[model samples]
Target: MTKLLLINAGSSSLKWQLVNMPAEHVIAAGQVERLNLPGTIVKVEVGHQKTKEVVETLDEIAAIDRVLKRLITVGGVQTLDEVEAVGHRVVAGGTLFKGPIKLTPSRIDQLRGLSELAPLHNPLEVKCIELLAQRLSGVPQYAVFDSAYFQGLPEKTAIYGIPYDWTKKYQIRRYGEHGISHQYLANRAAEMLKRPLSELNLITMHLGSGASITAVKNGQPFDTSMGLTPVTGVMMGTRSGDVDPTIVPYLMKRLGMETPEVVIQELNASSGLLGVSGVSSDMRDLHDAAKSNQRAKLAMDMFVNQVVKLVGGYYTEIGGADALVFAGGIGEKDPVIRQSIIDGLGVLGIKINQKLNEADHTGFLEAQDSRAKVMLIPTNEELAMARDVQRLMDAEK
Candidate 1:
């Protein structure tokens, strides 16, 4: 059995899964949260066994070292040599990288240079890649990007109104995030609808803490809510999306701020649901508090409003969709949010069945005779990365 390691390194966390290829079954999975901070949490699951720990990791390398140790001890791996290949999830490939590629030294340098594009993600991902190169020198490693699926977007939608020279010199364009999840969703929705992907149109919603919607036409990305960065889309757990461009400079002067970086940090970390609710960044917590809290209710209302507007706009952009598919954390589990959004889309003749929405693991939520089908799909980005790795490896042979 070929053991493949899939790593998704975030700004403050790292998630990994070890899958047995050919079988395509997960052997073990784990994540380390709050890296380089006190009270770091690590969790691992293998077979029927699971373990959680609180250990301090001084940096990303130490976090990785802890992960490898847990993988061997709790995950049943005798040694790191058992893993035949590693796949790293890179958040921002910019325009330079459109697809998954082997991580050669020169390519790694290119990835490092693109760090300015995705400060929150690419640096840590590159650090993890470097660590893998050091500890497992012979293993073949791949960089699977999150923005790759949106490369073929229409020119009008990808380009901004900025000066042409600056746009070209700085590579300014809409490089949408969450492409791996969106790509998996488009294919799975086609399968569920019993239609060829090339013949189906879809509006796929990935609504976790970091949310984005995609208008997919015939298996390709037509338009997405996220722009050049993940912070440009609808409101998210902590990100303030779709803010006025002038707000940066205005806030700098108004708030007595000194730098653009400080303003950007506030938008990225201090805003979003947390800012609106003044409670928590988690939707579940917001939902629980909404019954008595006005701010929480308002936050929920704003989030649902954003989702409904995006769906309606994309529906028109795609010339009407065959189905509106929902994935990600809240989409799959939170029926209230789903119902609220569907209610807002009554103009489109979309109706939701209460029984179906309440059912666990239910995919079809649209009522009979509704104008379009509504589907709920659990995203499998790790599987998508694994499949891409397998494809690239096969092509090389």
Candidate 2:
């Protein structure tokens, strides 16, 4: 049983898990929140026991050091050497990386080159990899890409209606993100239904601060909502998803912005729920404000409407769906959002058991007479990363 450390370094947070492979038993799991900010908190859980600490500093290197030390304190490991390998969840692999690969200096440089493709995620992921490499010394590290799963998207689905020459020269095509979560949901859905993944047609929704929906046809990624980058998917916490392309240029001129990056930054950071409602980016906040604020109510409505529209299109694109799987922060926990989206999808005869939908668990939520199954599957991207690492390790052996 190899011990593997799975790392998912986000823009401002770090989530990690230490697990025994083959058995897949989690030794410990934790995260560092408010990174690089005041009141940085580190939380760790071993079994049912949880611990939290307020640390003074948490730059990348310091964060890595703290996690290792906490692991020993929490009895997750006697020494750092107990960890046989490390796996990182890299957001964008582009077309260059189709699967998990051992991280070498050259490979790290290659990944860094794709930073522009995932500016918010890749650079940070690479930094974490480099930091871990120094701290762990000879321990093997692997990168499991989130975009790898969508590499198989059909050409027609991936290509934009742009000039072929430009598309070819710029690699401007749909390369969906959150693929790690989406792929995990699809596999879990297959296990729950007791069916071969190859035989299932699924629509997986990953709705969180960053949201995306994917269509799985016969076990493969058929299509997805995120395009070229994560910013193009359904409405997210702060991202303005699926806006008119002209809006960028129009905003630049209208707002007297010097560059397109300024407008893009607003789209990625100031729009969505926050932009529409002028409230907090969090869904819970929107729910509260929606009670009295029309803009907040509209924001919530727009989110549900966008999700339903994408699900409907994917359903038709896949001929029909066997199950609509929900996974991610809002998708797995928010019954109200789930019900609203499902209610909007009523035209397709999809219905969920209200009692089951409101339950605090993961499983089938579809009503008995519903045409297709509606499932709530909690995504385990870390486990998926660990599995990929194990697969690569076994292959090397």
Cα lDDT tens digits, model 1, 1-397, are: 7899998776456778999986899999987765655677888989988888887654777878877887788755899999899998898899888999989999999999987667666777888899999988899999999999999999888889999998889889999998998999999998889999999889999987778999998778999988887788899887888999999999999999999999988887778898999987778789889999999999989999999999999998889889999887688889889989999998999888878897845678899978999999988888999999988988998
TM-score for each predicted model, relative to the true structure: 0.90, 0.92
lDDT values for all models: 0.87, 0.89
Native-referenced Cα lDDT, model 1: 0.87
Off by over 4 Å in 1: 10-14, 30-45, 48-66, 135-137
The sequence of per-residue lDDT tens digits that candidate 2 reaches over residues 42-68 is: 999999999888978586657878888
Per-candidate RMSD, Å? 2.7, 2.5
**Which candidate number maximizes lDDT?**
2
